[model samples]
Target: MAQVANLFDIIHLNKKLADKHIAAEVHLRDACGRQTLWFELKDVEEDTLSRAQDVAISYFAGKGKPIEFDIAKGINFWIKQF
Candidate 1:
């Protein structure tokens, strides 16, 4: 009965890129209304959406919570648990 957390609300791309790297930012908000920002980089042979997805998977998986993209309406975009 573990609680499921929303990944999208926590991590998002900043739409900025440099060379073969893409920028991703993490935003965390606690019940106390405190927030924090963390910047991350993803290196790829070539910048593409597919590579971005791969980077995201690796990032979250490292956190012990793997997720997959869901395109269905009302469903969380990142919705797999591991």
Candidate 2:
């Protein structure tokens, strides 16, 4: 798992997840006076998405807030300034 240093890497990961039938959403934001990024998975089974989420979480964990994911729904991610 390489560090996501730019938008391209983010987009690439999203496509990869989608290719695997996983719905992933990536959001970028600068809010709350802090800079942070997060990834969420929705509209998927917990079992199917868990592995992906684990990898993602491991990559971005502790960067800010804990990553939030809902496999039963869809996948979404966001960045915030807090």
Candidate 3:
């Protein structure tokens, strides 16, 4: 909700400052095998979030679903709606 929106705002304003904020919230969105990695925050010229990020975060959070993304399992994600 506002949490992710505020993050986008900070990122748009200052990427350097956003790094600190993301680090702080790492614990909330992730554990050892974190999956809520929202957007690509590296080496990109564009300073905007992708459509995938916006829709997925909103849909998953709204439906109380968790997306489990695993690189080892053939690099895919599943929205656990069960």
Q: Which of the two candidates, 1 or 3, achieves a greater lDDT against the reference?
A: 1
Could you give candidate 3's per-residue lDDT for residues 1-82 as a string of tens digits? 2122233532342433253342211112433433334343443334333333344445456646555554662123444434
Question: Candidate 2: where are CA atoms >4 Å away?
Answer: 1-4, 30-35, 54-82
Candidate 1 stretches with Cα past 4 Å from truth are: 1-20, 23-47, 71-76, 79-82
What is the C-alpha lDDT profile of model 1 across 32-52, one tens digit per residue?
332222333234334444555
What are the TM-scores, per candidate, against the unseen true structure? 0.40, 0.44, 0.27
Model 3: residues with Cα > 4 Å off, grouped in runs: 1-50, 72-75, 80-82
Q: What are the Cα lDDT values of the candidates?
A: 0.42, 0.52, 0.38
Clashes of each: 0, 14, 0
Report the error of model 2 at residue 74, Å.
15
Q: List the residue pairs that clash in candidate 3.
A: none
- Residue 82 in candidate 3, Cα distance off native in Å: 9.3
| Total clashing pairs in model 2 | 14
